[model samples]
Target: MADQAISGDRVSGIEDESDLKRSITGKLLFFYVLGDVLGSGIYVLIGSVAGAVGGAFWLSFGLGVAVATITGLAYAELVTKYPQAAGAALYVNKAFKNRPLTFLITFCMLSASFAAAASLAQGFSDYFSQVWELPPPLMIGLLFIVVLAVVNFIGITESVVANVVMTVIEVSGLVIILICGAIFIGEGRADFGKLVEFNAESSPIMAILAGIALAFFAMTGFENAANVAEETIEPQKTFPRALVGGMIAAGILYVLVAMTAALTVPIGTLAGSDAALLEVVKTDILPVPLALITIVFAVIAMVAITNTCLVALVTQSRILYGMAREDVVPGVFGKVHATRRSPWVALIFAAVVVGALLAIAGQLAVGDPAPGEEKTTALEILVNVTVVFTLFIYGMVIVAALKLRGKDESEGTFKAWTPLLVFGLLANAGLLVYSVINDPTSLIWCAGLLALGGVLFLLERAFDRRRSESV
Candidate 1:
């Protein structure tokens, strides 16, 4: 299909008509993208990626960022063309006009959001335990979700503002890691040779690919920005730059952090701990008191996880609200609070589901361990599930972008390179297949979630039928 263009005037008209507050400027949107992309995945899963790729995990992060950026370009084009909320589902609906497919995509996005939030909540509890002897980490994780929901319920402006502050703090925490690594190197304790080493148990290609699958989690939050496109001021002009720019910036920081971690600490130490970055803070080369820095770093890591969870909730609620307006889901999800201007019902539902996920996942044993592999935790299971769902949604979005080409011909609409979108689709598919093959448990989790979506879809359809019969 031929690509189309969208005029600036139509885009402006759509933005002016949005119900959500347009409080997010170019600056806030930049941080929104940055904060989301730089979230808890790195803080929590750096160890998992290291385990997959050995000491050369930074390469996985770099390649993951590159693929995510390519996919982000496709989103940049679609969001500017459509300039509305609901993200991937919205794009897919526009391209295909199939209700079942649209609802499935919507549910996939929602499911991914729930899993991501739950995983981050787990990460938060992991860090929180360092500050206090918080037994029963699951309870703490549940409370974390509740607090985020409350923050989301207040309003969008308040939520994004808090996101900005948290983003700054998280970036500072990462910067501290870089600084400590520099000092460690100067002291002659760093081992730079590990930067090129791969896991001996697997081929270099398999190892790096596995690492990319985990590291891609850190690159995910950029897509959440598209769900708030309606609330972004002048989205067509603002989104392209902010979205792509934020992904690139976050990618660079991730590589640097990974390199520093690999050089400053032994690969075995990093690969074994859940709080891999915290191990960097514990490095004795720092001039300050070790305990003080460790505590401070833990707080910052919790803040970073909170920021990502907040963004994920925001995106989930918006997806429900947007899909409701399209009649792809129940109309109640579209209800906005009278004063708060937030989707309170959707927010509450999302929070409840995330809590349930945490409870259920905690009790259940997920995938079996491979030879020499340790049994997976609830957090790792959720992370793998989230990655699978996100990769599916991303691949669909690129295909949708390809299908929707030439449908919008107005001037000033952003367009992704056609070849890059194709490459992104293949890359996403490859990683998704690899994830399922490596851990079949992820497929089970995905199936269970999609089965839930299927149930909801049928119920919504039955309700619509009964209403029409009454009329």
Candidate 2:
């Protein structure tokens, strides 16, 4: 009954009569997924992966793709079944019907998006600083967040097109790295054996698992794509293909890029630098001009950061819009601009949080050292929280998929394998364990965030009761 033959296209789920425009085709949706999935994660997290697994960093990325695939399949099933916005939070609400849990999941997702946007803003500042001296990086980073917020408020169609352009620019950087590695190997200066070598840090299995925990963060932007399903044309048909195909493409690209990085540069060198991918190009192995290549890297790095930030803002605002519609949050968040049809109120709120976080990261980057503190940047702390909360959200989504299975047999044509759903649950739960073991600080940060969600939920309930009494 859900799959009505609407003009023979086999539409499932209620058609969205929202202000959101259905301009996203299968091709545009493909680019959207490709762009979001191929975000700053690979550009920024490669060094961390190398630090954990040494030269065999590709293994971690490979495992990350496998883990992401399991969840991606679950997402494909649910997004098509629901074919609405709000993504993971919506799925959670449908399965459990628990307001508190749904609020927590939704809040955690918003927190993750703000943290991710801040991280990307800081990344943009770092790369821009490489090209020109920034007198105050914090101010520059806040400016970046502001720019993204403005774009997000304009319209979804415009935002996705910008993402497509930026995606092309960012993917070019990876292609160049691969070509440089090929040239290096041809000259017999690269060590092909390092491709399989793991340093003496720990057992190989533990190292790969550790690396997978970190690498998993790089593959997460795919899930956020579900938030835009409402804007997608024939979402039930296109979402599953875009979500799964995009992940596969990004996974292959990640593996190839990781192998090239390990083969072309020493693991120690790659592990030490935050801008490790740039090192591959600037190395003597490549005959390109150092200044030209550095500038190119700087430009592409900014593009990557901006692309990810834009997509994050889009999803975060949509999640807020979805929550507001459900009365899980303030109704103001659901308001769409009359002309642009964008979630302007939600965009403003998301921007304020992201901008504040960026300012904090900027201060942490430049402020004088505390007496004995390790001088960690706010971006570093927030990225860890983002990873932890993201895994938490993913775990709940897989559970929701299992619970909702067969409940609506006609809701979606695609069904995730039950075994894979179980695997996804274990994998996400295992990653959460690894995250806590590796960085216990994440547990504290996530706890604080969840507590804030609880407080907000109670406030909303009280306000709703007050309004009803007045009536």
Candidate 3:
């Protein structure tokens, strides 16, 4: 097949008009990845990770960085090499030469994105309710999705500029928590030795590995960065640096926050509290009034969730638009707005799916709350599903990198280290197996979703054949 020209109006010849605007510069791309990588994962996954790894929670997060970096290298190489909007699905199609497989990978990315958006919506609603009484969480979550979709339909540059502002505010919140931890240490109220403590029930290595699997959930935003390649200016020259730099910066910041959290707060206390980071802030070290601290924490949590959902929705819509261009799904998804130059149809479709997931998941969990807990908390379940799907996607992407390693570097492309690619493959495979063992229900969800993708793939294929014969 011939490659498409780089016309502003058509994204890979899929649209009749010009495609998404190429306004994202190197700096904007950096913040986009940084803000997205530092998203709801830290806000929601920290406590869950602490529960798994005890006081040595930093170890798990560090390990997650290492693993994410390995996979990130694969993404960097592939995104620069292809420089398209499809991301993993595009690489898979190129390497494997299988249309059905491509559709499956594309759908997995979209579904995982929806899961992330849905989980973040619930988080937003949960925190919003803390500040003010609200209607049912499902309604609030749906409303948030609708609002995000509107912002997305407006323009990519506008969406990403808003993200940069949110990213700064969110990072500032983490900085405040770090300062509070330092104050506690100066007062000699906390034991720094606790930073190395491991849970007595499990061996140290086993515990850290378990924590890595959970921590890996927070490390996934880097791949979504690849989905925006088509919208970035000079992606081949700009994406590799931004992607790797953003991941490394986010990892260092995460480790610092995890270490400060471990040293300043009791593992048991942090593990048990849903608002674990808030607990660190509300400690006497900050010297803020209780009501003021509560409001600050709520606002920060809402910003983190909003940043996450916004990025996920953007990535999901682009993936659908990419797949639509290939006839893997309906063509309407590839329809770009004539004036706005955005994938308006795909944007609305993604928002509706995310809203439905949030509504259904919230209702299901609400019906089965544990005593004293406000709800049954299916957020972790949704997060788990995303992790599983992402792991498989990561595995395939690494495989694609290996498959494409032989391509020339004449265009400034380079291959990741073979050992790192192998290691990433093994790590992803191991984590997928472990996740299935721990939460078998996640596999059922993955299976059902993949099956849905298969049905759509067959339909699109048949439709293409008929259209060709008619022509």
Candidate 4:
């Protein structure tokens, strides 16, 4: 059989496209999707779940898996169906047949991508801080941005290669955690009951779903895989497998990890710091090797997540380029780098914007005077708002998958199974609804941002028309 995917085991293809023109081996596509979806969200957010859900921390993780399953099914069918390079933007536009709707989906994704990048950079700063009493997060975030930019500018191939290696190492660390937890069970320090119970149910169904939304954040990167459809070999088949598999794996890991953490360490200790996983390894239950393993996992986890974020940011720039290609913005932004075959202009611009956001987060965390003043609180506020914004975009994607069921088979392979799309949209919509109800303030902020984005998108079109009329 001909290959239909890009990254061999890591999922990058030779030029990474699918058509009558290119194909990838199914297994290679599976691993590529696996590596891509398994990036850093779960590693970093484990602490947050413990903080919110108490002793039954795995419940939060279980919620994430359930939610991800619903959304993953939707994405699988769509990627198999459309196989377009445009991803969420293209799908929604096709579904609604409205430019504004398309533009909104693209804008929401770009903003959410930027926020996610910023969050990762900030998280990177936190981890680095644990190792080095080094300079503040601002300096760290800046340095981190510089490091990734240089790597990205080198070539997409290099970055993808690095991503694959990182994915392997990170998954190894998670495996080590399970092994260590098993040892703890032998030592008799582990409490199996706390891990099994869902005592948090007293909080109401909506509250539980609200916690699930945050937990759902851990299972995110799968959708962004679609953005690489242009760079995928047999995207139609490969993306569906990778996206769904990655999601399911992450969900299971999160649940098991949460269970073990609850069993060994008290919820108090886990919630005490951002480096919650570190606490688990340091406890009397496991020896230094486990902690050491987690430290290694930390490196893989952070780099992998960072790598995923870089891919996502690149997608955001592509949308900008696509908009420019459609005359929605200046044509110069549309030109791809002749040498690298990457979007150089968009890359630089996105790096600067996201770097700025990270800088703000750094300043806010430590109570710095300048942007730091509002940076911490504002970022916290935006975190929840970003949840709403991202889900809204996802909801659109689900709808888009349903809408494009009958496009030209000449266009791609793997059209979404229609029933799955409906199920996925409702899942996404449920999360969106929970986000609004639980944190109405954040929802308001998201709506305002969308309004602002709407105005800018429309004005860009208006300005383009004026320029055309003058010509």
- Whose TM-score is greatest here? 1
Q: What does candidate 3's lDDT look like per residue over 1-471, in tens digits?
A: 233444565434444334444788888888888888888578777877887889998999998888888999999899888887678888998999997688778889988888888878877776777677658767778899999899888864365667789889888888888888778778888787888899888889888987887788778878878766877888878888898888898898899889888887788888776667777776657777877887887798788878878889888887778778877777888999999898998999888878777766666766766676533366767777888898999999999999987763555785678998999899999988988887787788678666766776677778889989999
Of candidates 2 and 1, the better by lDDT? 1
User: Best by lDDT, which number?
Assistant: 1
Give candidate 1's whole-model lDDT.
Answer: 0.86
Off by over 4 Å in 3: 1-23, 156-160, 231-237, 337-341, 367-376, 458-471
Tell me the deviation in Å of residue 134 in model 2.
Answer: 3.1
* Ten-residue stretch with the least lDDT total in model 2: 1-10
Clashing pairs in 2: none
TM-score of each: 0.91, 0.88, 0.87, 0.83
Q: What is the lDDT of residue 295 in candidate 4?
A: 64
lDDT agreement with native, every candidate: 0.86, 0.81, 0.81, 0.66
Candidate 1, residues 1-471: lDDT per residue as tens digits? 122343554443323333445777988888988888787568989988998899899999999999999999999999989887668888998999997798888889989988899889988887888888647788898999999898889864365667788889989999999998889888887777899999999899999999999988889888888767878888888999999998898999999999999998888998878688999888776899999999999999998888888889988888778767766667788899999888898999899989988888887744465788677777788899999999999999999999999998468888898988999999999999998898898888888877876766676788889999999
For model 1 the TM-score comes to 0.91
Q: In candidate 2, what are the lDDT values of residues 44-68, reduced to their tens digit?
A: 7787788779889899999988988
| Model 3 pairs whose backbones collide | 9-17, 9-18, 9-19
Q: Residue 17, candidate 4: how far off, in angstroms?
A: 13
lDDT value for model 3:
0.81
**Which 10 residues in a row give candidate 4 its minimum summed lDDT?**
372-381
Stronger candidate by lDDT (1 vs 3):
1
